[model samples]
Target: MAEQLEPETILREISDLEGRIEELRQAANMPVPDLRATLDAALVELELALTALRTMGVDQANAAGRSATAETERRVLRTVFQDAPVPLFLLDRDAGVRRVNKQAAAMLGTSPGYVSGKQFIAFCDLPARAALRSQLAAVVRTGRRRRTEVRFLGREHPVDAMVTMARVWIRGEPDPMIVVAAGATAVPDGPADDERPTRTATPAAGTAGGAAREAAPLSDDRDDEVMAALVHRMDVLATASELLLDEPVFNENVAVRRCARLLTAEMTEWVFIDLTPPRAGPASAGGTGAPGAAGHEANGDLRRVVVMGQPDEHGEETVHSLEQLAPEPGTLPHTVFTTRQSALRPHVEDLDLLGVCADGQPACVKMGATSVLCVPVEDGDRCIGTITLASRGEHGPLDLLDLGVAQRLGRLLALVIRASRLYQRRDEIAVSLQASLLPQRLPQIPGVEVAGLYRAATHGIEVGGDFYDVFPAAGGGWGMVLGDVCGKGQEAAAVTAAARHGVRALSGWKSDPAEVLSMVNQALLDEERFVTAVMAGLTVGGEGMKATLASAGHPPAIVIRPDGMVRYASSGGVPLGLFEDFEVGTQVIELAAGDTLFLHSDGVLDACDMSRRQFGQERLLEVLAGHAAAPLQEMLNAVEQRLIDYCDGDLRDDVSMLAVRRQPTPLN
Candidate 1:
């Protein structure tokens, strides 16, 4: 049992109760009929109780009875607060939620714990947010009660209601908090849903200045709705950027798919992306696709690239069926793509706005979409594609806010697509340029089997500088030249072209390998670049083939016999294009039947594995010896495969190899 209250204390308690009842009466005049009635009945009962208390004055009532009456009044107030008919939020001065009733949590489609500590205004839609912030601050500063309309962004859908806010001072806190009461807006008798006037939100403006303002008058709550929608859109763009840019290489197809999946998660129930083929001409500098603007149609029709829906049992089947529906001309998606503009239809009266599905059912009807928004994917003034967004009844219909967001997203995706295509074109050009630098075919020399291979390093987009050539030499002999320019890309390719052609031309009359290499060095000296090369002059005799090899700071040539015998031939010399009198390493060897010679660039020896271990000369020798008994081309293939496998397919430089084998039986 609690201690008895003094007469003075009892009087103070009566005064507090009377003040609370009066406040309740003032709040009861709200627009909600059910809440007003409840408050009115509670006010009457409270007045009756106060009258009885007054009748039993401090002189008549004992201290213990006064204590019991105070306790009973507290219980009634607690009951009223917890079981209020409408949603209520208790917020600190900063508008941070301190508590939310069950109705409030239900309105947010979340648990009370999730709603607590969050900004109370964040729940309101964008347009309403700024106004709510001002209202909340005004109420806190002035201690005045206020009412305003708000559109709450519920997890499932949006809820529109009128909210009343009042300042509330708690016992332990120095500053007062705010108490917000929200009631559902009552609708007067009206026409059926089908008969209701269709309200279509205007698409975003084309100019920057126009984009800053709303086309239609924004209701107090609508502003908050717009802000919330904008925030959601910005988040989507940030995530899409991470997803698309994180790839080792940007793929347009993968980007669109990822974007579609992301939209289904938080923004919409269904997403469709359609793209036009890349144009041959320069992208058009067309209009902003504002309403009434002429369409900028691409050469090709729009092809459906992605389709996604919210997670459900039938989602996959629905996606697959809808994938068969392409956007024909005059359809919403096609029109948006052609016009480079956006379209927002809140109440989609024309079911065939999107083309029909295979079953002849209207696409929007099958997807259960009440509203749709389509925006063009534009790069600069040219429209590249279209993104169509829809939602089921779980979310509110797409409106002007959604149209603005979709348009911005479409523009973002267009930039990504443009970048991806540009990279692809660059790679293609590199490939074609690199191919043009190499020999189309190696000349067939009787009594000799010659094969060469060139593989570019896989790490970069630029062309490599490794080159090899086989050409006719004096006295019915063959000349082979393999060289590596110091760098890559066009600069190195230019030097490579000069060196390969110089050697082939010089070897025509200069049969001696040393003389041919020395002249080649002088020819490249003006290039002010470095090139390592090994040239071999082979003359077929009635007995066997005599080979003269000259090295210019190049990798040593490997000589192999049929019985797995391996030896190296190297004449250490400075690389070409460095010195006018650089020494040319020269070696002479005779190749009998079933003997082969191998020449390669330094790339094979420099290849590194994941552990950064190099495939050195010792490994190259072992590889050659292991495959010595194989045919010429097969042996080269085996060596190349071993080099790639040793480095786990990561070559540090371009690999080029030339192999010459003296056949056991001479060519007919």
Candidate 2:
């Protein structure tokens, strides 16, 4: 359909139009030409001249009895040759160019016609000419593709090109013609020609200064292209870094998913990330058990975490790989992970996917994948996972250049993944130390029901200083203690644990609440590790319970009557672990049936809302008055939820709440 009208046809029509215009000029006695319209028409005519030349060539080559389909195929091939990324040339069996693409013409500093019918080796530097010819000869003889790097001399200097040769058959020719493809790679400027390195392939990886292709001093234009590509890749890495940095929590799965989203934007059309689970070990403290490098031994199972691709979000790009088994040996991800290297399958087929398909993931046949690449993600020195890539866009199969891009991204993800695991491990260790310091479950006390609740600040990443314990006293009574250490983190949590443990240990010798505080305060000699606590020694009676309380710089206890009246108990003293000779103070109270006593940390009264207003004691007491008759556990739950509602973000400090209620006599 792009076969344009012949230039001669356009010229004849212009001639006929000029004759008509001349007749009009003579009849009207007008000397001025329709110059404006004529000039515009000439401009249009000039633009079509190139197409006219192409159309003329097409007409000459289009033999009679050729079907329309064959003509269309010729047009498609012509279009591809004109716009392809690399130089392409069709040569005779002797390596003389028969037809050359526009890219090849550009390289020769001439038009397509000027480049045709020339020996292909003539463009190469003298040193490479012989080697180039032999490779071409072998490819033509064996009917296989041959790859080599050649330095082709340009008008200004030489350009390094990765050249591939194969035999291509044309319908009218008896012998297959040679098809040569060349991908240009930039070479940095070297010392004035005398110091130039020998033109031979360097490294087999990256396009820049790599063994996969020979090197030569390049022009400034070539240098610019290479520099721009390096910058582009750096930009991709920077973008991925910014995305991960945006999150407060450097979660492992979140990092992988974000990487998949970013890579799908450019790196790969589809990405399948398979992460190996952390090796099994005892949690250091309170961890979610994500393994760190110290526990990097995996059972060799990689669970697919993210699947993303093009055109559609749900279809083709999606994989239900959670139902699949671990990657088996010889599969794409497995081979890459085990070998600790990348694998590029330039062309993929259903037969190559027998193991992949059986593993609950959609096969290449379903996703329409044309090529695959697998790169392993490393954490520290161990490979943590493999990122399998599937590409199906115009970018074609994965090349050495593409592999470089994937490798850089994998390295970035590995660093972040390892850091996230370490952070979680440290957090868990702190939580475990804090947990072991407290009772596993509340001790049941006669005639009283107790419930306690605790929450660490800082999104559970750090241990809170809050602590609580319930244990039996020496004289057939029970003791309950709640305390909060100054500051937070591992150090503060250690002191809080020590304080709770000391109280439980000393409760065996002492039944007095004040004496328990006095002994624990002496043990906490670190001025840096002081605590404010409220201790209670309870003696249960037949119908009610009497509790003697000791306050060590903690908030006063509040009592809620069955009729909803609320009152604060006498609880005020110098906080323990600060002064060497501070007096231990105690307050006694007897609670009737259906009454409750509430003890709390200062985090409640000092908690700030969005408006920066503290939830003061009056408001807390007012709220307690309303929950006076609620069950002990229900009261504790409601109180916690209320505090959470008041804080806009995470709690600013650790919170601990303890409640003691005298259960009503059994109904008869």
Candidate 3:
């Protein structure tokens, strides 16, 4: 009934069956049929032969299809895992590795096969095992994702791991599938330790068979944490940038102290800043030593450690300077000088200096410090000084390269210092000019208690454009103008002088506040310059204490009642030089007996602290309310002190406040 098969066809069938059997064996499974037995049995029973052949063909076709599908799936999985950027691993419910990608295997310094079935704890170092174990357990119990960091004992780097657990169904039964993605958080600073196995230089190539597949969704909730950390760092750098540009405090010792304290807090260590001269000896010998010092005495090699802070200390403080720390020949200073490298001096040992040195002193040293990082301060070709950071206790040794951050910080410090010095020189010139322009003292005025305070911004290099004048009007009342130009430096100062003289000269002709401001503004506008100001005329009369005010884009004066209530008389007007047709506005206020009025420059309100919070108008009113009853001088002093404190003792603009109090005539 059935046709006989050819010898060649039968041989081909046998070969195909043998190959399938071999593939099944390789996959750790067994084949179902033997080709020779099936053929021999078919020949012995002719009728049954047809039926057996039909069944055998169907069975072989099904087996062949399944084998091809399984192979394709395995290939696809391998391709997906290998191409992943983050390290990935699959583990059993017991935390035993089932499979790991190339990256994970590389990170663990082992082959995937060797890692398979091994306990996860076996790869992690002591410091990381406990945390990882806890996180893994939580993920498995909750069927959720868990994130952690692990430090492998033998590896030089640490890895951040994200683990998620899911139920994998196999043959209608559920099994645990743990997915992990790991990435290195920091680069290793040293050589690998002996405790970890060494990895091969090249990984074996995977056989090509199937298309790459997609990875499952990440379960770890680390995106927010990472982004927050980055944002916080960016903000810190921005604040630092603004602080560095501030002229007045940039070079001040206190400024440096604050910067060091900031670094200590951010980096979690103590910081020390030093400013030493380039070379040792007197200036005559081409060194920066103090004048008239002996050459052999190391005159020019001056050292000054301006700021230092220990985390254990209550607050930021200064440490020893280079001059104080200068040791005898062949000692600490000499060693540092000769070495020209950073020194790490641990608490238990003496200082070890590292770097290029003509003298044979060690470049890196450890003293009583548990950890220390030191770097030399270099400006171009010359070596200026050194900065050091130290930590005690179980924190471990310092990473010198990591301290390059401090070095970058030091460079910024140097720039601020240089700028501050230039600002100081300019200030001296401005102060001289301002002194020549202003009257030596306020003119005597009856029935009015007048006081003025001029406080320069804590950080600027030049004197501000703010200026005030108090002189008797031609008729009788007192004439005063408080004004500020739009900018800083010599040009602004020159304009300020011109405006002030113009007001004084104009008051001789015009007694009205609006007329005086109009004349001044016209003069400035004619000169094509910009300025803002407020002018006021105060007179005592039988009717009441009369005051007339005019403004050119300046803040209105605050009038404080004797009962401590304060009101602002702010009739607004355009700033000077903005337009040719600008008109100054005037308002009249009758001051009751014992009332006080305060006029101030906008710099007072613009002052901001390190946190960027402003000392606003509301705070100014509160201060005035609190000190209304005090003497004019006392009130101004208290307000100035509060402003200074609010700005954290560093002002970026000039402040001028003038106070006038109308005291009731005493009963005679």
lDDT of 1 by residue, 1-668 (tens): 22234577557545744543543343232212234333443544454445445544334336466456545644553676656766778888777888887677766555678678777755664323434655665566445688877666554356667889987655546556788888766312322444312122222211111112212355665566556556666677788778877766667888888888877775777899998766543332122333213333346578898888853455666677789999998689988776676887644545578987776655765576655789998767567789999764335456666677678778778887877766666667778878877899888888788999999896776788899999998877889989899998878878988888889888889899789888888888888679999999998876578889999999989899988898899659889999997798999999988789899999989998889988898888888888887777787788789988988887779999999988777469
Q: Candidate 3: RMSD over Cα atoms?
A: 25.2
Candidate 2 ranges beyond 4 A from true positions = 1-232, 282-298, 311-318, 321-326, 344-355, 359-362, 395-402, 526-528
Each prediction's whole-model lDDT (CA): 0.72, 0.67, 0.58
Model 3 misplacement above 4 A: 1-274, 277-301, 304-323, 327-376, 387-444, 454-463, 488-490, 526-529, 541-544, 564-572, 602-628, 634-655
Model 2 pairs whose backbones collide: 201-211, 201-213, 202-211, 203-210, 203-211, 286-428
Task: Locate the minimum summed-lDDT window of 10 residues in model 2.
Answer: 196-205
lDDT of 3 by residue, 138-195 (tens): 3443344655555442222333333333423122213335666665554344323432
> What is the C-alpha lDDT profile of model 2 across 476-573, one tens digit per residue?
88888888888877788778778888998899989998988988888886657789999888888877889899999888888899898999988778
RMSD for each of the candidates: 20.7, 17.1, 25.2
Q: What is the lDDT of residue 19 in candidate 3?
A: 39
Q: If both were scored by TM-score, which would come out higher, candidate 2 or candidate 3?
A: 2
Superposed by TM-score, candidate 2 places the C-alpha of residue 620 at a distance from the truth, in angstroms, of 2.3
What TM-score does model 2 achieve against the real structure? 0.64
Residue 95 lDDT, candidate 3, scale 0-100: 62
Q: How many residue pairs of model 2 clash at the backbone?
A: 6
